[model samples]
Target: MTRDFDDDAPRRLQDAGGLINARRRDEAERIRARQRDDDERIYVVTTNLVIDAQEQLARRRRLDRIWRAGAALSWLSLLAAVIGTGIAWGTTGDLARFVVGYLICGGLFLMSLLTLVGVYFAGRNVSSLQRLEAHLASQQKALWQLKVKSNPDVDERGKLYREEVTTAIEYYQADSRKYRTIHNRHRRPRRLCGRCGQLKRIARNARDGQPDLCDGCYQGPDAICSICSRIRSCASRDEQGQPVCVTCYQRHRTGEPCARCGRTKAVNTRWPIGPVCVTCYTAVLRSPAECPRCGMVQPLIARDDDGAEVCGPCVGFAADYTCKQCGRAGNPHSRGRCAHCVLAERVNALLAGPDGTITPQLEPLAAALADAPSPFPAIQWLKESPNTKLLARLASEGHELSHELLDELPPNRNQRYIRRLLVHTGVLEERNEDLDRIPSWLEHELADKPTAHASLARPFLHWFLLRRARQRAAMRRHPACADRDLRRRVSVALDFLAWTDQRGLALADLAQEHIDDWIAGATSQRRYMIRYFLKWTTSRRLTRELTVPSIPSQEPQDLLDDDDRWRLLQRCLTDDALPPDVRAGGAITLLFGTSTERLCHLTPEHLKFDDEHAHLVLGRHPVLLPPRLAELLRQLAEQPQLRPQLSRAHPGPQWLFPGMVPGKPISTHGMTQKINRTASRSAPRATGRCPPSLLISPARSSPT
Candidate 1:
């Protein structure tokens, strides 16, 4: 009996331990359940309120329908009165009877007008209900948040919603007072909506003595804006007594030349020097300049006793604009941080991963954007640009950013722009855009083509056109014409294939006569493009050897006379008002007969400086430059950059004429346009022989 008792005691002890753990787990689970209920209470209540509101709206809509039916009955009664009046005047021979009938008809008309007014009020109520329903449905989370923060239990409440919900919450809180005033549940609205005729809270315009308007009716006073020339809610009137929108009013009112930037803009502030625009005012306050008096970096407010620039403190005035974080003398952007600091924080936030650390891949791009000379534009771009959102999404998702990943996204201008920025900042490797875009373009073109046509055209493009293009792209930067040329060749080849297909003729069975017939029907330029496909197919033994006749060079029909040639040359040499690139490029075209395509490749190295003159290496031989032209070339070469901010970190060759894109020279088309703008007339192709007038000039003649 003692042995049995000992074993039972140990088993009972083990069971007791298991029960204690189970009880603890159950208690914890109940606590967690209570927490969950507390957390979800606001959302649950908000949902219930919305559902009740919707039900009440439906009941109100039913009432509006009944009102509409009564309005219809009123219109029918008015029509009956009109007919009765006509009958009384025609059938009633007595004047007294007819007059009485007319008076009764007039009373019916008055009643109908009153009914129409009721119908108008019903329609306005319907519109208001619809707007409120949409707002409630779309802003469910906002409603939940409002309820949480307005809870009476919490002693101190932090904001539970973003800035976007501030207005809505303010309006809701004002309306909430009506419910709180238990004695008067149906408070009268302050003002009626002018447009809708619904009674609601009134908000008055700050300026222009506009009418008092309810929230729904208030859009600002509509008038023809003088600057934009569109009827809109005018912000203010200009000096000419014409209405202007908010944007135009700010930009055009009290316009004056800014002393610092030398741009005519609306004066925001007055300095001793002159009127300053808002941009220049902010820039001057924020950017520290070297004070000549003390040789210290500070804002220049006043001149010293010696007539040299000095800091505000040097002149016994304390500085007002200074950053709190960095302690730099500059205008604060937000939270007492300067624009530069704000830009850095915003860039870091935009490029940070889900872990709140920037990826190694995106660090360079973030650095470039943060380190921009002007922070205002960068800040504006962050707020408005869709590209920033795309970058944010990519960073948050931790996606491996590459050219291939970017290509997978739908091809758009934004995608292309982002890719260019990434490539410029060394985040992505540089590749020829013209070459890379061809494959996608070809795929889109072939998507609707027949299988036979695609199969035939695919090999020709891959082996012949694309292969040659790849080789060209590898050698040098792709010319602007390369994309158009490749596309033209591909399109013509496809057309040739399609034409052959239509006639039920195979390439293997094709003859020279078929090629001739096809070329005969094509345009003049397409005739030359078809030769590429013929040569490739012949070499591949896909078709018989075909002879595509070469297009003979046509003589110039509009050659410039000697007077015109000299006049353009003189303008190129003497016109200081013309752009440096135009003057230099136009002069070279006239002298050496150099094509604009060749001029695009010319760099600073092409110009040789000597003791007396400058020589340009247009071809293998260098040509002498006139004194004025040489000075222009020297100035063009010495200038730092065409676009300093954009091309600051470009690693490409320094061309005589740089384009907007980093790491690229000016395109042939861009240079030609510049020349055309200056010359005022397009110069025809010159005859091979040099003009006698050019031959006499030492600058025009090529050196031995």
Candidate 2:
């Protein structure tokens, strides 16, 4: 039974194997059918994708054709406008009709230009579409590759095929998403023009991606400049400010260049040249001329042989004649004589007098005049009898011509003139007139004494005097020094020196006790002056180190209270009956806190006026003058006779407040006396105070 079962098993196994093989065949057929279905589906999807890509390519090509057609049409329109404008210009008989046709053709030409620009932008868009279509074509190629790679025969389980198909599908889906994103990004929304209110697609800013105005409104010629209100196409906002056209902006940037000297400086005035620099304008206003020979800009004093403008220096050197007697070079006078030779003849004629009688006084005077360096002094002496008499008196007294002698004379005009001539002639002794009043005892000590103490004291005295003289000169240059104060300082210095000498102490041996003793009995003014001298000596190492007693500080009294200042200012402004000098002086003093001494020294040259402002040069810096004060100063400057009427001396035109002495500003004492007198008359209420004199006290009392 087992043998029979075994033989039956082989047959059963064969039957079972056949049945299993048949089932496998059915499964293989089912798998092959599914593979065919998947291939068909893939082919269908790839065909649809390829068709879509082709459609996109066709659409891009159509856009390119449209762009090219629009560009051709724009060109044709431009050519047609040009031809029509030329025809209208050539055929029109009436000017009005021609102008109208020209305007129409010009408008057509501008529109055609705008159309060409739009077509160019459309071409760029078409290029972008072509790039997108090319990208889609590449995607279609990749999908075909994916389809070819996905073989159901090689991968019978279809795992790798399904994976590849899924990957390609995802890639195509991603490409579609990318295209949509690009399209949405490139597509701009339409915006209305701010100016014309026309709807148009605005281009986005590349940096911030914000929309900007349409080309028509942005480039319109109707835009106005904020500054000049001129219509222009090239208008833009400048420096975060208002919009300005190119012409107006250039005008603002480059101001008119100076016409004279060709400098790009601020224009002071307009001239035939165009504009002028302030320096050239001032020179022109002064009536200066350019010298043709030397090419120097100067006042026109003479003409050259060619009749061109020549400066004084050039004219002086161009003289044709030399003096016969003095051999000085100068232009020829009448009769071929130079100026010096002519003046020599005049001096000789004056020396002979009308009767040709030469007196004893006249003989020496004539000899001195003949021996003089220049003929000017002799000629000047001949013009004035007083000068001749003064020279005769000096010659008779056997005294050299000196300032001391001149100063000893009465402060008359003739004396002052002679003194100035002596100074100019270099015959006067050069010494400080203030130092002549030094104590005779001190002078004797410095000159006669030869002791160790005197040796040190002499040089110290000399240095002090030299320094004081320099200070006085500087103040006189400002014309602000007070002679009384200078004399007082000298007196104080002499007293201190004498006191120390009496104590048997040299400058090198000076101790604090001597300084303290000096300060013990001295007035505040004397103490102040002595302190200055000691400080100078210590600085120069002429004395041993010593402590100087500090003077007690005291507040200076106000010269003018607020009420007084108001009253004074009102009087200066309104009072016409008051003398102009007094009014002007009072105003300057009250306004600038200047004393009478400074006011007296003020000259017409000190006051400067321009178109916009007025200035008074009181010190180093110029003080601005108020309108009313400026007018008062102008009035004061205009009046040539501003000297006090009490004096008969000719003060000359140089002094604003002429003193009793000619050619000198008013003395500080004289100024004080005058102010006292004017104060009584001008401000009768302030009698005992002497408001004008009080002005000087405060200035003098204040520390320098």
Candidate 3:
């Protein structure tokens, strides 16, 4: 007991000093904490309650303000008007009381009008503001509730906080019900940086419409490949010309051996699905190296029209059905037979049938198609008339009928007779004695519209032209042309002038500088050509003041002395090739010839032989043919390749040098462009020596 006591006493003494010091320090900390809490007394619940009251009061006040504006303005205006009218009436010597009474009534009426206007505008504003406030208050309810719960306060804070907290919870719970909706409308979630909250994009997202990063984040390309971890930024592409990205490029540098070839060359990763690199993605899509059907490079696609890998005989073999009569299966879409068989069967069955063959079900269609060259003309006839008139009209229009036409004919029961007439007339026209091939009279009519239709359209066209020019200018100047703004403007102006000329507007009114300015601003070769044609061909006479410099002369020998004469020669002989028809020829001859106006169309037959030489018959009389010019004509007629048979399939049908398109001949202006295009001059394959020779208008005109 004595020994134990002695040991405990020393230990107690040592602990007593440390324990007392710790106790004092802990007690002091407690006091300091309490004081700090008392000093910064936070009343969050009270704050939220006060804010709620303030927002409600402010909204009510705004509503009251709006409502008062109309009432206040009406009352004030009435008072002012009544006073002024009364004074004015009294000045005119009216009884003052009566005048005051009458003015009061008039003022009241005026007040009513003013009141309504103010109320309309103010009421609308109040309604809009109320809706916005309601939305904002709902959205902010959660924040307010959170603020209150975080800090307790006084003065009805508990009730306000409790009510708002419930509302906030309800709003969230209501939104929670849309979990399925959110999932259903799932947009891709962006991957953001954990460090700085930056988002990542898909690979190759920057240029080429495929960016891997936003503009600021993109470091042109990876310096080293992601896959191989080799540095190859400066290295050239592989044998296939693919630049590997840095992460993958590191393993492929020249110093490092290629995995494929095992040589010290730039490495490229080959993918089974797509191109070697993202840079070549677009190049492959247009003309992919791999065949879609066979998964091989350049598979043969003789069978499907869309170029399927399988041969023609095998394609649609599964889909094809056996033909009843022929017992052969063909294109399924053609109903188990070839188009030729179908056409022949259609013709034979209807006209003179083998027994029990579907008795010529489409008599009207078959007959109508016999004359029409294409189905469009035959269908158009059916659309216009029922029977006889349609055939007459189709024939008159020079439209032919075909087997395809019969099948394609639009079904409108009203014009059955027209179909019959169309079929018979087309068949007769094909025999060529019907005088139905786009008749000379209709040609006359196309040139000469009825006076009334011409008059009606001309003024409207002029107005339309003015409005369109302004609109075209605006479109050319829009944001889409940030790269080529000036060039687009020039092209638009030149196009407008040419369109105006084609619509029969005289170019004589426009000036040359108008065209020159347009050309000067144009950056492309096509635009330059269009600008040149518009001024020199279409509007040269109208724009006498504007001097377009001659395109540098490609012609080696001849130089006209007068500048204006050269311009006249260019106008007379169009730079572009013209159709060899009356309309086209007349325009060219009118400009080039001294008197081509009186002369009319002279066919090849018109050029007759007299003993040894041929002479062309003009309007009525024979003009002596020039030998050299005659040789040029001979060349045009004899050479199959050089003669330019407008349509190879239907040759020698229309006027000489026909247009490729039907319903329109080559424009005289086009003739001028064809002449100047040093055929092959700028192209690689062009022979350096003299090219094809043809007669052009003499390079001289009347002296200025």
Q: How do the residues 292-367 of candidate 2 rate in per-residue lDDT, one tens digit apiece?
A: 8777655444556776556656856432334455544433344555545665565455545434544443454344
> What TM-score does prediction 3 earn?
0.21
Q: Predicted candidate 1: what Cα RMSD to the true structure?
A: 28.8
lDDT of 1 at 191: 66
lDDT of 1 by residue, 1-704 (tens): 34655768878999999999999999999998887687578667777777766765676677567666767766766777667767766897545665665567567657766766866775564545677567556656556565565563543233444433564555466667643452232232466656566656665532466555776666567888889998888857777787789887766566889877799888887655567788987767767787776676777766666766567777666655677787776656875688888988999999999899999998888888888776777788887789889888888988879988787666665776677778888888888786686667677688889887777677887888888888876776425447767788888888888888789999899988887788678656465678898888888998888888876555444456678778878887887787777787767777777656667877889999999878998777998988988998899889877353443345666788887555567766566556655555433222133443442222222211
lDDT of 2: 0.60
What is the clash count of model 3?
52
Between prediction 1 and prediction 3, the one with superior TM-score is: 1
Give the candidates in order of TM-score, highest first.
Answer: 1, 2, 3
Between candidates 2 and 3, the one scoring higher on lDDT is 2
Off by over 4 Å in 3: 1-602, 618-620, 626-653, 663-665, 678-704
**TM of each candidate vs. truth:** 0.58, 0.35, 0.21
Which stretches of model 1 miss by more than 4 angstroms?
1-266, 272-287, 317-319, 325-337, 349-357, 374-397, 407-420, 430-437, 469-481, 595-597, 619-622, 640-650, 677-679, 682-704
Worst 10 residues of 1 by lDDT: 695-704
